[model samples]
Target: MAVFRESNAAPYLQPVPPVVGDAKVGGAAPHELSIGEIIRRERRLSQEQIEQILQYQREKGVRFGEAAVALGLASQQDVLFALSQQFNYFYAPDAKRGYSNELVAATQPFSHQAESFRAIRTQLMMRVFSQDDVRRAIAIVSPDSGDGKTFFAANLAVVLSQLGGRTLVVDADLRGPRLHELFGIESSSGLSGILSGRAETSVIKQVPDLPSLYVLPVGVTPPNPVELVERPAFALLMRELLSKFDHVVVDTPAAVYGADATVIAARCGAALVLARQGRSKVSRLQDLVATLNNSPAKLAGVILNEY
Candidate 1:
């Protein structure tokens, strides 16, 4: 059951219904917090306000969230946040923590754009990461920079993690790494440190909001990214990571940079090429496709990044 949603409309001005799919993803385990408790905590509602909301809920015969909204005690976003807490479906409606707005999947899980990422995630899960499949990593490559490769890889990893599986995104782009910045974590020691054997400390960091999502940033940018990726250590690292993680997404240097992407894709054994709608040149896209087609990696798909 692959989900494909394309409506990138603006977020709702009023609370409608939570987007469907919570059940198929997985039933929420029983949580200890009530919606009212969650809203009170997040909104800093007073004891009197809580009593008012309870009385209103009983009198109006509505749910706690609807009653709160009606009484103007909490905003629609507040109710959504409370619901997320009760359901174990995590998102940062206030952008207070979790992930930055750049990670639409985490900040706006019910939005159309976020749903589209879930659609892509469903496809990848079915094709490349089935329960029986041996290969688990997919390298995201684009013909050139600004093709939304890192953005796509980051969001895709978020949605994959939403399925409750441990997912990791590797910043293989040692040349110009940005996944750490996108994820809003420190890049003090990451993939480069591990591959170069200079890492004396733990390089992988779990995303604060997403317990299932982890990142391996490019620690200290080396003078030779190409040489670093070409070593046997990189492939061995990918294999080891694949064994440990349910899903792995490798962000690579653009094809125009050098053979880094191709080599990385071959090592990961799967690649998803990205092409920007208006900016990407057809010939360059074709050349990248051809180059990847010659490699050992399976060409999973080419996504036309409209965002």
Candidate 2:
């Protein structure tokens, strides 16, 4: 019984209900991602807002596309392109992963939300990313099926790279993984591989564009992920990854899926709790906090998500 979501987050004002996918890709666990249409709908502005967009372009020399991007009014890709154009920036996409320069662009929709999330992430990294603590500081966000934990991990890793640190985002969600999707790469080697001994340590992919940010996708979801995460090889991989990267951010399985996150906590130090404001339920938050309490990781703090 696999669950799937067809699209990512749409703008709060224009949300399309999530579509559940019955088919599992290669029989991997079920998951969801906002489709292109859903993302585009996020930027659909009212007629008044449209007029303002046009006026801003006419008066400020900012085109509708550019202005929309700056406002975080579009999808992640759109924002990346828009911002890149606005700022006169360039970044080489990862050749291996087909990393897009579009990732560097910023849109009004993402830009607004990123400002708040970036500060929190930056502050957290600053606090915990010491030489001794980098191995222990894992940012295990709350169960945000769509509020951008993978996106945060990818961009946050870049911010760390800018600070001259080698970072890796280990995608631990074997049942439902999408870390590779963010980098536009293949998720064929990840926590599952190390456990199965199918991938050597060198298999960890250095994501394009975000040079300092490396990655390990959940890889084709394993039939039984619980045993895989509990393996000693997984722990060894985490330790070795820490040795290689100055900072290692394990994007553990979402909070709703209990044991996987607990396994992540057993090996990592702190956790970053993420819960959306209007979309998340108080019960879900309660369930998340309660689950983490049973894990070995220390509670760093909660990061309430903003849509």
Candidate 3:
């Protein structure tokens, strides 16, 4: 596919012209950026710092997004969104609202968690910070819940919101939907609420700070979550979401429990499987990876939770 360089890109987001290795397009991949490496790349991410970087890149004609992609933080293509359709991760509550600074506070230390999160958020600011399409993914898994899927999801969504991506966290997990709990919102009225045609759109809660990350908390538990997940209505919802927001992220159940994870994966552009530090089973996740290979959605990869 022909890669369309961002028309207004400050030149810094483009690939360095000539690269080495499968993950490169310009000079020898700028050396795999480690956690420490990236933090150094950014002197600071404040508006002034960002402006200075953008100004310097604009003057030098550097491609910031490409640079980030070369490091595996950004995709050269709209692969994230395209993959979502290719796999069928088409379930969603709605397009998230506008992003806010408050969201960032909710999800502190995002850089300390997933290295990808740090870089992606930075690159997203290059072209589309205040839009949902920019940051539309949230990886939610449990090291038995207390380990913090909802915490992470809520925070991740918040991060995206701060970075100008209208985000949303869907309680697709009928088993234990607790995003509302994390945000101190109402849980009795979300996906299930709208799916079963019980409540109006008003039922959906607007998470604070994360006003950009809307919350369609898990509605009434269904008898057959698998069936609900497979319904055409669910698929349509996802497409509609893409049209409405800059980004939409759903908080799904674990891979071990039900088909919900697979269903959620099918609708999103990609998937991030999270496992806890000690409680999570390596062998089981390996099996889960194998399971994702056969799933309708594409497996972005696993996120081994260190904390």
Worst 10 residues of 1 by lDDT: 5-14
What is the number of residue pairs that collide in model 1? 0
Q: Candidate 1 on 1-307: residue-level lDDT in tens? A: 1222111111111122222233222244324567877788778899999899999999999999999999998999988877776666665575768466788888888888998888888787777777464775899999999998888889899888777667789999988999998878988887877777776676777786566788889989898998888888887787778766778999999989899999999999989989988888999989988998999888888888876
Ranking by TM-score: 1, 2, 3
List ranges where model 3 is wrong by over 4 Å: 1-147
**Alpha carbon lDDT of each predicted model:** 0.79, 0.56, 0.50
Clash number for candidate 2: 26
For each of the candidates, give the backbone clash count: 0, 26, 30
Tens-place lDDT digits, model 3, residues 71-102:
44434332232232223221121124232222
Tell me model 3's lDDT, rounded to 2 decimals: 0.50
Q: Report the C-alpha displacement of residue 81, candidate 1, in angstroms.
A: 2.4
Each candidate's TM vs. the true structure? 0.87, 0.62, 0.56
The C-alpha RMSD of each candidate to the native structure, in angstroms, is 9.4, 14.7, 16.4
